[model samples]
Target: MKPVSSECAVGIDIGAGSGAKMGLFTREGNLLGESLLPIERYGRSPVVMVGELAGALRDLVKGSGSPPLIGAGVAMPGFACSDGTVRCNNLPFLDHVPFVPMMEQAFGLSVCVVNDADAGGLAEWSHARTELLYWVFGGGWGGAWISADGQVRYPAVDWDGDDDTLHYSNEPGYAIPLSRERMGVELASLGGSWEGFERICMAEREWPGGRLAGPNGRLDCVRAELFVSGNGRWRIFRTLAAADGYDLARLTPEERQALETPSNAGRVIDRLAEQGCPVVRRTDLMFGRALAAAAEFHFRSGPRGNCPDGIAIYVGGKPSRALPWFGPEAESVMRARRLHASLKLSWFSERNLNANLAGAAVLAWNRLKGS
Candidate 1:
């Protein structure tokens, strides 16, 4: 832990992993230091986790030297309320916990808690004055809207603490479930889980179809076409997965076992991808379509009205890191809806990876400045 270059604020991102990510960012937006601490080592006890995180943070700050930590912000996987309660379904141990007070007491500094996706949005808003919509496609879908004034405007009014999901009702809907059901057989062969499907998506550069036995003794083959959201909950676009002539019946024992459970599916999918499955491309294309559908719905019936002036769209999270195919598909959907506004798809990288942390740092700094 080298000494940081200047005065900085601390930002933390807590997710489903064994630890939480923390970063030190300057008011100028430079990330001076970053670390991942094993807070989960404290187990499912929220109070214990908070205490451990505080101790670890104290050590990190002390090791950094000189420049004082003026304020701190936390990006947790939950819905943060004005009353300081956090409703985290993924981390159910933290349900109804008073996060801000807990952190503020432990760190002896002002602390603000926000949803991880909102933090990402704030990170984007910090750099640009343009209105934007940011989506995080990771463990579960979540998003935020950034205004021209550089504020992350979340749909707080619609948040139900007991809903048990990270996302709010105002953002784009989750698409993986529908995608799985639509591409059932392809996913089944690949192992029937997102991990397996995502492996194929990343491995193949092209999509090829296969002809397999259909119901009623019909031999149907279809190319992979994604289902898009229409006017309401119904799929706006429909297509067939025309079978290309290929053999899919040969499955290794490992593949069979992988298909037996959701957890094993990813490993199987990875193996299939390594063996060069062509259908991976189709799943990738479908993901792009999902992004498109989400954006369309956001503007059409979002908490905010249509952005006639258009909005920049920032896609973040684990999936966005692996796939760079959301821009075109999202724009295509916007066009199909006859709503043309500038839709920019931001890729995942260092430029945006620490958005939540950066956003949190900015918020903390603002609090210090009494702004």
Candidate 2:
């Protein structure tokens, strides 16, 4: 019999901000290469954005010396259905657009679409030798999970008792209600939105004295410009804390100094822990978000009685002291270790490559094997 041609697949991960990444992999799960492309969307015009992105991806493949393209898997933010219609929250441009057919026409390849967080979970599971895996998106606190056999088993439309209501796990917007009624007001006053918090964190890092550039003494500047710009809240906070005392008008000199001090942040984290809440550093929060997603996945998928052996993979930057409010790395390690021991599972972090690509490779390999 003639040998069957090896299948090659590509995984495309689309973020809420129209950021795009593509991963190329062989049927055996070996990664060939990956690239990031920009997708410009104009208000609910996902069709246009996907078309533009498909063209760019085609160009990337062509530029890469013509690697054979078999199929493509896409990870997109928003509500996606089995029929391929996507109702994107962050990128309204894709609202109810038929992305699968459009991509098929543009690239002439079979395409599978999955939720972005689900894709991250699948990728992490595929790369590691674990029976359970979780993927978390920190910016909006979105999460998803996969089982040992590569099946997504949590946060499904009908999984929990709530059949009528759709659940978007890990989306802070959908988080368990906070008891403090003024918490929202406090969050807003601090910056206005979660994104606002991230911005103050980032500006505090990128541009010292940047806080003074906005209303509320640079609060609006960080909110309007930096935080909303992308996912760099931790960096922003670090920068601001390190800057001269004048940058933080919100806090008195003594308070600012106290915040900048390592011991203070540790105490804050300890207080949160004392309350039975996990006080993750912004950096570790990013890491734990991913881990939590994996844990949730396992809890929902494995036998109801016990947890399974699994792994959590995180893709991001190394934690730094710039984000003092996030607490210390030692705290993160200790917490993670305790969680793993208690849950009887394993967790791992990889900051090098995007997790979506790793997921696409797995999907492609599975399809190639007819599994």
Candidate 3:
């Protein structure tokens, strides 16, 4: 293993849901510590919130004995310039915010900013075996091709027609119309957003037995029936359930009971199985397929031999939430059933230091040393 440099880099990922997490990654890919903070929406004033966030980070580092700082990497939800000008439609307040300079001045450290999905892809590529990898999250997607020699081929940036070089942008969601079309209706019906679908799906799964309820009372059945009627929602639910292990007969009983108790969206799968749907509970195929599609696109779009091995770094709640139905064994089973490319899911939760942060640190260390 390569030794990390004396300097450290921080990877700050800002989620669209107003949550922020900063990971302090050493050159050896060791996450020294992390801080999660909530963002308050105060009308186009992200600078204030982010400044406060930086202050919190400073306090964390100072309290932890003041390790030497080197550079920082940020992952934001919108298109970002090399200098860190962010234009996130969702974060209207952050549009055109000079976040990089603000943080750099606040922390007295160098800062590098990238799109959130791009950072995820970079983190994933840092651990990937293949040279080329594609990554996607709920709102957007991106790709990165890593050479065996460790050179990263980023999508070109079109800066005033002066910096027109080939850079890889993980804007797959923008390029792939079908992906958005597939989920459009469901997203709208479900309150015109996909922010918490994963949590919602999990709630539906655990409803009758879990803890979510409605105004009338326990809402297991009502929610399930509404989800079933929606095309995208139904498909996503069915696919996830299939990945888990429920059979058709079990699904039917659950669905019937859910009809009586709408909030029972949690048990719809079991009910559907009982009613004779050939569905089985499985991992969230939507997330898996979206990621696979992005990778596939990257593999097929460029020079064939130049394509690098693929990797994916998933940063979210938990594999259980994102990959709820499938366990490690089930991943292979699901792959076999789908007969698609062999894509693997590696969990990189914050709780696990080695799995999540080490690889990126090592990769960064190698990059800085020109290895």
Best by lDDT: 1
Residue runs of model 1 more than 4 Å from their true location after superposition: 1-5, 155-158, 161-170, 174-278, 302-309, 341-352
Tens digits of lDDT, candidate 3, 246-355: 44453356455553332234345434434454333222334343334343443455643135433333433222133333223334434544423344343443344323
Cα error, residue 370 of model 1, in Å, equals 5.1
Q: All candidates: CA RMSD in angstroms? A: 9.5, 10.9, 11.3
- On lDDT, the stronger of 1 and 2 is 1
Give the better candidate number (2 or 3) by lDDT: 2
**Deviation (Å) of 88 in candidate 1:** 1.0
Worst 10 residues of 2 by lDDT: 221-230
Taking the tens digit of each residue's C-alpha lDDT, what string does model 1 give over 120-177? 7777777665688776654345677777776666444325533223233224433112
List, residue by residue over 201-256, the lDDT tens digit for candidate 2: 54445544543232223332222212211133333334333332224454456655
The model with the greater TM-score, 2 or 3, is: 3
Question: What TM-score fits each model?
Answer: 0.69, 0.57, 0.58
lDDT of 2: 0.48
Compared with the true structure, all predictions reach lDDT values of 0.56, 0.48, 0.46
